[model samples]
Target chain A: MPIEDKQKPQRNDRVTIRTVATHAGVSVAAVSKVMRNAYGVSDALRAKVTDAIEALAYRPSRAARGLRGRSFTIGVLLIDIRNPFLPEVIAGVNEVLGPSHYQAMIGVSDARVQLETSLIESMIDYKMDGLILVAPRLPSEILAKFAVQIPIVAVGYHDASATAFDTVNADDQRGAEIAVEALLACGYRDIEMLSLGERQGHAVSVVRQREIGFRRAMQRGGLGSSPAIGKIPIASPKREEAMRKFLSRKDRPRAVFCWSDLDAITLLSLAMEMGVRVPEDLAVIGYDNSPTAALGLVNLASIDQSGRELGQVATRALISRIEGRTASEHIFQIPSLVSRNSLTRSGSGTDMKQG
Target chain B: MPIEDKQKPQRNDRVTIRTVATHAGVSVAAVSKVMRNAYGVSDALRAKVTDAIEALAYRPSRAARGLRGRSFTIGVLLIDIRNPFLPEVIAGVNEVLGPSHYQAMIGVSDARVQLETSLIESMIDYKMDGLILVAPRLPSEILAKFAVQIPIVAVGYHDASATAFDTVNADDQRGAEIAVEALLACGYRDIEMLSLGERQGHAVSVVRQREIGFRRAMQRGGLGSSPAIGKIPIASPKREEAMRKFLSRKDRPRAVFCWSDLDAITLLSLAMEMGVRVPEDLAVIGYDNSPTAALGLVNLASIDQSGRELGQVATRALISRIEGRTASEHIFQIPSLVSRNSLTRSGSGTDMKQG
Candidate 1:
C-alpha cells in the first residue's frame, strides 16, 4: 500500500450536506430532503444521493441535527418486559437495528390492552420512528389501523391479516407437533398440554395453533381421546392451585407440555410442594426456553424459537416497511425443541430419565 | 358510571392541534416546535404552548409525526441481552419511563466495545433522546465526548471523577468482603478466589475493586500469608481451561469464591468434566446470582447486587440529569449476598488437606 493511496481523505469530520450534494450533483436542500426521507425527490436523485452516501461511507452527524429527525430511536413495546422470551427477541432486533443506526427503547405492557394502548400512544407522542409489539393481545383492528401511520412489526402472531401490521411468528402448529413428538419419542402416550385461550378466535393466534397442533399430534398417534388442556387467565399465579386438580386425577398424564416456562416453573414448584417427583411420577416440558427456565431448580425442557431471530425478522419487516415496501404479510419463523433436564421420562417407566 | 361521562371524554378526544394552537394564540408552527422539543422557542411561549397541550390533552398523532422530529423512541444498550440480572434493572427503568411517557428500545451490545460504540452511534444518528448503557466497556474519553452531545447514563461503572456522565455501580469491594466473610463463617480456612484479570486498567472497572476487597478481607482474617487468587479471562472460553489447575491442586482451598456466577458455572462445568464432585469435594461461591447460577445442577451461592435495582437507580439519575440536576455525582450502589447450594461444607473434616 503506497502512502499516497492510503492518505487520509479530505476533512469530512462532520460529513456536511454540502459535500454529499456536490458529489451527487444536487441542491443541498434536495440532499437534506433525501436525508430526511422527505417527499418530492425524484427516484433517480434519491438513488444518486444514496449511492454517494454509501461510496463515501458517510455517517450523518446527529448532534448537528439538534435532537431533530436523526436520533435513530426504534421503540419496542413488549407485552411483558420481564417475560424471559422477549429478551432474546430484542437481542435479534438489536442485531438488525445495530447496523441500521437504530436503538430500541422497551416498554412492558403487562399484557393489558389499556396499558399497551397508552404505551403506544406515548411512543407516538415521543416520536419513535418505528415500533415492535411482541405477542400483543390487542385487537388486530387497532394494529392494522395504526400500521397506516407508523412502521410497525408484530412478533409471535402467525396469521397475516392484510389490515394488521407486518408479522413475524413461529410455526406454532409445528412447534406444538415437535413438543408432542418429543414426548412420543420418549414413549409418552398420555401427554397433556396447558395453554392460553384465544381472545378473538383468530387462527393466527399462537395459543390457538399450539393447542390445535397438540390435539392433532395426539390424534395422529392413535390416541382417540385427546389429552387434557388447562387454559387459565394469564397473571393469575394460582398455577399451583389450578394444577393440583389435574395432578390429583386417577389417569394423570406422564408429562405435561406448557405454553410458557413460567407456568412450567410454577408447576414444578407446585409439584415439589405436593411431593410429586419430577421425571418419576410426572415430567414437564415448556416453551420459550426462558432464561429463568434454565435456573437450577427449574431446568425446564423447552422449545427454542429463538425470540431474537423472531425479533430480527420482525425488525427487518419494519425496516422494509419503513423503506417504502408495499407488500408484507404473515412471516412464520421455525421453532426448535431444546431437550433439557426438564423433559426426560414420558408415559411412565422410561430409563432415559436424566441424572 | 353513566355513559354521559364517557361521552364527555369522547368530546375531549376531539381536541386537536389546531384547537390548542388557536387557544394558545400562536401559529401551528410554534406549537409544533414546542411539541418537537426543537430549539428557538421562548420559555414564555413554550409554557403557554405546554399549558394548552396539557389542558387539551392534545396528543400529536404518531402517524402524522412518524416522518417528523420526535420518533418517540428511547434506546437501552446492554452488553448482553441474555444476562439474567438485567431484567430487574429494566423493570425499574420501565417503571420510570412508563409514567413519564417515554418508550425504551433495547440493544444487546454483546459486551463488545466496538459493538457498543456502533450501537450508541446508530442510536444517536436515529434521533434517540437519551440512552442507558448497562455494563459498557467503552473508553471514558469516548463516553465523555459522547455524553457532551447526548444524554447518557452509564450503569455499573464506578468512576471516581465527579464524572462526565451519570453512572451507577455496586460497591464491589464491600460485596467481595461479604462473600469472604460468609465463607469464613462457614469455617473455610483455606479459601480460594476465582476472578478475571485487570484488563486495560480501566479505573472504573469492577474486577479491580473486587480483588482489593478480597485481599483486604483475607488480610483481616489473617490469611494474607498466601492469597490464593486464580485469574481467568472469562471473555474467552479457552481461558476456562485454567480451572483444573486450581481445582486439582494439593494445596487447593476448601471453599472457592468467584467473581460472577458465569465464572462459577464454568468452574462447575469443568469440575464435572474433571469428575470432581461439588460441595462434597469443594465449596464454591459466586457473585451476580445470575439465573444460570441457580440451575438444578449448578446451585451456586452468590451475591445479588440486584441488577434491577441498579437499573432503576441509574434511570432516576439520568432523568434527574435530563431534568437539569447539575449537582449529582456518580452513584455507588450497595449489594447483598444470596447464599445457595454452592457455598456449603467447607473447613470440615480433611477437605483441604485431603485435596
Candidate 2:
C-alpha cells in the first residue's frame, strides 16, 4: 500500500457536523437540533442523525463549542496539595465526574490569596462550566463577588448566609466537639487544644470553627471558660518548635486535641523523641482522620469527617447550580470519632479513670 | 453606590484589547504584534501599548486567545496523587512557574494509561502551551507522536534515546546502587530486594531501571547473579500480605532493599507487628526517602532523589521547548542515601558488623 493510503484517519480528518448532516440526508439545522436534544426535533430526524453519528464516529469539537458556550470542564481550586486530606477530596470529585461528560481541571494556589484569585479568574476566562473551591482562604464577601461570574460550590468553607454560592462543609465545629468529648470521656481532666496560629480569626475558616467547638465543648464539660489553647505556627520549623515546647513544658495538659491530623502525627513523633509516652504520659486526639494517623506506629485517635464525601456532595451541588438551581444551599455533615491506641491503652473505648 | 451603578460596571465595563489599542493611539494590529512580541513593533509602540494595558488593568481573555493560539497555561499530568513524592515535584514546578507568565493546571490520571492519554488529549484540545508528565505510563512512540502536536517534558521516565521529547530524571540505577553499596558496607552478604510487581516490565519505567541497578550492584559485590528479589503487589490487601509473608519466611534474607519508601514504611509497621526487630533481625532500606520516612516512630533508611528538583528542572525544560528550543535534552541528577535507624541503631552511619 502507498504511504498516504496506509495512514489512518487522524483527529484532523475527523467527521464533522456537516458530514453527519450529509450522511443523514438532512439539513445541518436538523442535525444540530438533534445533537442538542432540542424540543423541535422529530423522532425520525433524531434517529437518522444519531445513526449517522454512530456510523461516522463523529466527536464534536469541545474547543469550538467552548468558544460559543459551556466548556463542560469544572475547575477545582485547591488551597494546598501537601495535605493528604486534599487527595481524598480529589478522588471523590473524580469518582462523581468520571461517568459524566464533564471533566475537572485542578489548580493549586499554595495557600496564596493572590494566586487563588488569579486562578479563579483564569478559569472564568476559559469559560469553564463551574468551579469547586476546596478550603479556600478568601473571605466570604470576596467569594460571593466571584460567584456572580460563575457557579461555585465551596467545600470546607463555613459561609452559610451567602446567597450567591453553595457551601459544603464537614461541620468542623462538631468534629472538634467530638474530639474533645472523646478526650474527656477517656477520663482526662487536664485537656487543652492545639490550634493553627493565624493573624486573623475569620468566621468562614474551618480552623476557627474547630477552635470555637473546642472552647464550647470544654466549657460544656465544666472546664473553665479560659481553658488553655496553644497556637501552633503553620511553618515547619516553628511548628516543630512549638510542639517540642509543648511536650517539654512542665505544666503540659494530660490530654491534647489537635486541629488537624497533620499536626497530631508530628506531635506523636515529637512526644516519642521527648520520651513522653502516649496515653500514659500524654494523650492525643486529632481531626481529619488522615491515613498516616491510621498507621500502627502512629495509632492516633481522630475525628473522621470524610473529605471524599464532601468532594462528592460539592461536585453534585455545583452541577445543580450550573444547571440553573438558583437557591443557595448550605449543607453540613456531622463527624464521628475513630478510637486508637494514642487515646487510651485499651484502644477500644474511653477508660473512665480521672487524670 | 446604587445597585444599578454597581451592576453596570461589572464584566462588560472591563477593559479589553481594543480598549488598550484605543488608549495607546495605535492600530489594533500593532497592539496585537506588541502583545505577541512579534517582529515589526517599535519600542515606542510596545511601551505605549504596555502602559495602556497597565492603566486599564486589561487581562486578555485566555479562552478567546486559546481559540486562536497559545493559552499561556501548562498542563501537569500526575500518575497518582496519593504518593507524597509527587507533591514535591508539583511544589518545584509551581516555584519555577510562579515568576513566569505560565500557569500550571494539573490532571490526575490515577495511574491508568487510558486516563493519561485522554487527559493529554484534553490538554492539547484546550490549546495549552506545554505539558509536564510526571512518571507517565505511556510508551515512548506514543509520546513522540503526541510531541508532534505539543511540547512535552517527562519527569521520571528513563527514555534517553527518544528524540521527540525531553526527560529529567534522578539516576535511578545509580540510586539503587548507592542503596545496595550502603547495605553492603554494613557487611551484610545475604541481601534481597522487594520490587513492584507489574504485568509487564517496560524498559522505560523507573522501577525497571532500579531493578537493573540492584542486580548489577549485587553482582559487583560478589553476590551470585541470581540474588533473591521478592515481588510485592501494588494493591493494598495483597501488598501487606506479601510483606507479612516475607517477614515470616524462615529463609528470608538478613537485609532487604525496597523500591519505595511507601512500601518500606509499611514493612516496618508490619515488622513491629510480627515481633521482628529492625537491624537486629532484618535490616531494611528504601527509595525516595519521603517525609514519612523521617518520622521518629518510622525512621526508615532510604535513598533521597529530591522529586522537587526533578519537577523544577522538567518545568524549565518544558518552558524552554515551548520557547523554541528544538534539541531534545536528557538530564539526570545523582541520588544519595540517608542513613537512619532502620538500617542501624546509631542512625548515623552503617554498623559494619558481618552477618
Candidate 3:
C-alpha cells in the first residue's frame, strides 16, 4: 500500500517492519536497528529507514516494544468492578493520564486472591510500566514481593509501614470516627455498627481499620468499650435476610453506623419496605458517600472519602517511583461527613469538623 | 532463581530464558525455538530445554508470545464506565472466561471518539486475540476497517448490514415497543420519551432504534406519527437541569419513557424533590433494568435487556470468530418489561408480552 492509500477509509493492511525494510531496500535486521536507534547505524541507512517508515506509515508494535523496553502502558487491577467507588478511582487515574503518552489497561480480579495474583503476574509478563492495585485481596507480604519486580502504588490498602511500595488512602479511622460523632451529635445514645462479614480480616484491609476506629470512637464517647458491631453478609438473599432480621430485632439500637454506602443504601431500602422510617425509627450513617447516597429518595448521611483523589495521588506516586524515586511514601487525606436526612431530619449539609 | 527458590515467600527475582539456556548448556536461540515448538528442534533438544525450564521455573513473557503468536488475552472496550449497566456486561464476560485459559483486559474510552479510536488501535498493536466493544462511539466504516485486522464482536450497536464484524443486541426497537404498549395498556394516552442529546445521531445507536420503535408503536395505536421526545443533556449540572426543566414543563406528559435506567432513576429522584407522586402524578418506564431499578426505594419499571447475557453471547461469538469462522453473525435477544411502582399503582410483576 502506498502512503496515499493510508488515507483511504477501507485501508486495513498494517505496515510492519518487514514492509518498511522492503520499501527501503534493506535487510529486516538493518531496519530494526535503525528503528531502535542502535549505535552502529550510519546516517545514510538511518535516513533510508526513516523515510521508508514515514512513507509506509509503519508504526512499531507495542508488544514488540514490551519485549525490549517501555510499552508506555500502565496496568490497573481492581478487586471488584461492581463497586461504584472503583469507577470514581478509575476516572481520577484517567484524568491524570489523559494528556500524557501513557494509557491505562484495567483487569478485574473479582476479589479472589488467586485471580488477583494471576492478574498481577500477567501484567508483569506483559511488561507494563507500573501497576495501581485498588483494594487488592492479596496479603501485604505478597504485594511487597510483587512490588520488587515492578513499580506499585496501592489505593485503599492500609500498610503504612511497608518499605517496598507506596500507599494512598483516606484516613479510614478518622472517617469512622466522624460517622460516629455525627450520630452522637444528633442526641443518639444507643448506637450500633453494621460491618462486612469478610472471610479474611487482614489487618491492612479497610474494613478492619474501620472496625478499630469504630471501637475507639465508641469508647471515647463513654459508650461501652465493646460497643455492638453487627456482621452483614456480603452477598445477597442472605444479605437481605440478615438485614430484615436486624430490623425486626426487639433490641435494635436507635442509631447505626454502616461500613459502606453500598450496605447503607440497601438498609434504607429495606427500612422503607419494613415500614421503618429513617432517622425516625433508625438513624444511620455510612461511609464512601457514593452518588446513590445523595439521591433525594435515599438521602443517607455518609463519610466522604473521595476515591477520585486517592486514584490521582496513587497515579502520581507511581509515576514518581517509575521516574527513579527509591524511598517508599505513605499518603493520607482526611475524610469528612456529609450529613443528610438519614442522620437527622434537619441534616442536609457538609459537616467538616474532625470530631 | 532456581525452582526451589520459587516456594520462598520473599523471593522476587524473575527467572529469565537466559537462566534456562545456561542450565541446559544450550544457546538462547535453541531455547526460543524449542519454546515455540519450531519444526527444526529435535527430540533431544526439546528434552534438554524442557528439563532446564522445570529446574529454573522460567516462564515465557506474554509480550514475547504476543509478538509471534497468541497471548490468550481478550480486550474489552467500554465507552463509559460510570453507567451501572456496563458492569453487568463485564460480569457476564468474566463468567464465560473464568473456566477457560483466556483472560480479559478492559479499557475505558469515556465516550470520547479520539480515545476510543486510540484504544482500539492500541489493542490491535498489543496483538490481543480478539475484542468486544460495548456501545462504542466509532462509525461503522471505521469499525469495519478495524474488524479486518482482528476478530470483533460489538454489543448494543445495531448495524446488521455490516459484514466485517458480528453484533449482539437486545432488540432495542422491540424493547421500546413493549414500553409504549405497556403504558398504553395502563390507560396512558399522553406519553413522551426522554432521550440523550448525543452529538452524533448515529442510526446504529440504540437510542435511535428506540425512537423508531416509539414512533411506530404510537402511530399503530392511533396517536400521531410523531410524538413528543424530550432531549436530555448527558453531563451533570446540565443533565440535572434538563430533567428539572422537563418535569416543570406545563405540557409534560402523564407518562414518560427514558432511554436508560441511568436517566430514569435520576428523574425519579428529581420528581420526589419537586413533590410529584410516581404513577399518580407521572408514570415512567426505563431501559436496561439495572440493579438500581430493583431497589425497593427506586422500584423503577424498566425494559429488561439482560446486559450480562448480552456480554456472554458476545464473548462466545468473538471466540468463534477468532477460531476462523469468516462469516459475520448478528445475534439478538428479546427484551421484556419489569413492572414496578413507576409504571402504575398496581404494577408489581413481570410483563412478558412483546408488544
* Best-fitting candidate, scored by lDDT: 3
**Tens-digit lDDT string for candidate 2 (A300-352):** 88999999999899999999999999999999999999999889887343222
Better of 1 and 3 by TM-score: 3
What level of docking quality does candidate 2 show? acceptable
| All candidates in order of DockQ, best leading | 3, 2, 1
TM-score of each: 0.77, 0.91, 0.89
What stretches of model 2 exceed 4 Å from their correct place? A1-61, A347-355, B1-15, B22-26, B42-48, B347-355
Indicate the DockQ of the complex predicted as candidate 3: 0.40
Given candidate 2, what's the lDDT at residue B3?
A: 15
The local lDDT score (0 to 100) that residue B279 gets in candidate 2 is 80
DockQ of each: 0.21, 0.30, 0.40
Candidate lDDT values, in order: 0.72, 0.87, 0.89
lDDT tens per residue, model 1, B146-213: 77655788887766574568888889999899889988987888888888764675666677678778
By DockQ, the best candidate is: 3
Model 3 Cα lDDT, one tens digit per residue, B1-355: 4433333343536677766876787888899778755557778888999999998868778898788777789999999998999999999999998997788999999999999999998898888989999999899999998898888999999999989999999999999999999999999999999999998798999999999999999999888978989889888999999999999989989999999999999999888888777878899999999888888888889999999999999999988888777899999899998888888876333333342
DockQ of model 1 vs. true complex? 0.21
